[model samples]
Target: MKKPIKNLGKKLKPCPFCGRKMVFHKEIRINKYGKQVTYQYYLHEDYDIYHDESCILDEIDMPFTIGAGDANPDTGYIGEYAEDWNRREG
Candidate 1:
């Protein structure tokens, strides 16, 4: 038998500190009733809280980071971060 579809509505919130808008970036798929379904999701607001930053694309260092959902391998480190490592001023 087939199952009823579920509505997946807005799942993002704004940052409390910086008031920046957030969006759904990640989700988990699971098996339910012999069918594939979406499970727990990490909201963007929660990400901002944990990251301790307001802007999602702000400066950050992940090479020496020690967290599960903290490192962003796509964009690498921030420009200012690289300058700081080189001990050079902008």
Candidate 2:
């Protein structure tokens, strides 16, 4: 199982449509060049509160700086992406 990454002191705003809290999800992958790429974004799972089982929203992919091997992966992009998404009016 993949563990969700921490928000690094950044907090995602509530969902605009359902007012449910958003969760941060991160994925780390190794490219062909042997660099670690970190992808961080936010997701709002409406199913938890509404029980509709069909609504889901997510922020666009945010890529982090490439890192050597898997050590000290760069996830600083997550904070910037979260800040921008949280300010959305809709």
Candidate 3:
């Protein structure tokens, strides 16, 4: 099993568009079958305050997974998700 992504000890990159700090969030919810599903994503808190629903680009959810309902402990996996979004040009 892979190691779980740890929020501690790692530095989150800033949003490229607004120069504001980025945040990482992981939500664990149980599916209908009672399996724990982890939804990992990032958000630009400052950007959401001024933008409308269609204009908001703050939340970026990870689109892929290692396995079916698998909980990965690899910090790098989740970190990359945030990093990629922060590096987006628009």
Model 2: CA > 4 A from native = 6-10, 45-52, 56-78
- 1-90: candidate 3 lDDT, tens digit per residue: 223333521345554444555444557788999999776544443334335541223334332121212223353444454445446565
- Measured against the true structure, the TM-scores of the candidates, in listed sequence, are 0.25, 0.49, 0.45
- Number of the candidate with higher TM-score, 2 or 3: 2
lDDT of each: 0.31, 0.46, 0.43
Candidate 1: Cα lDDT at 61: 31
Query: For model 1, which pairs clash?
Result: none
Candidate 2 TM-score, C-alpha based: 0.49
Better model by TM-score: candidate 1 vs candidate 2:
2
Clashing pairs in 3: 3-73, 3-74, 4-73, 5-73
Q: Which candidate is the best by lDDT?
A: 2
Candidate 1 versus the native: TM-score?
A: 0.25
Error of 3 at 50 (Å): 8.8
**Model 3 regions lying over 4 Å from their true place:** 1-10, 46-78, 86-90
TM-score of 3: 0.45
lDDT of 2 at 12: 57
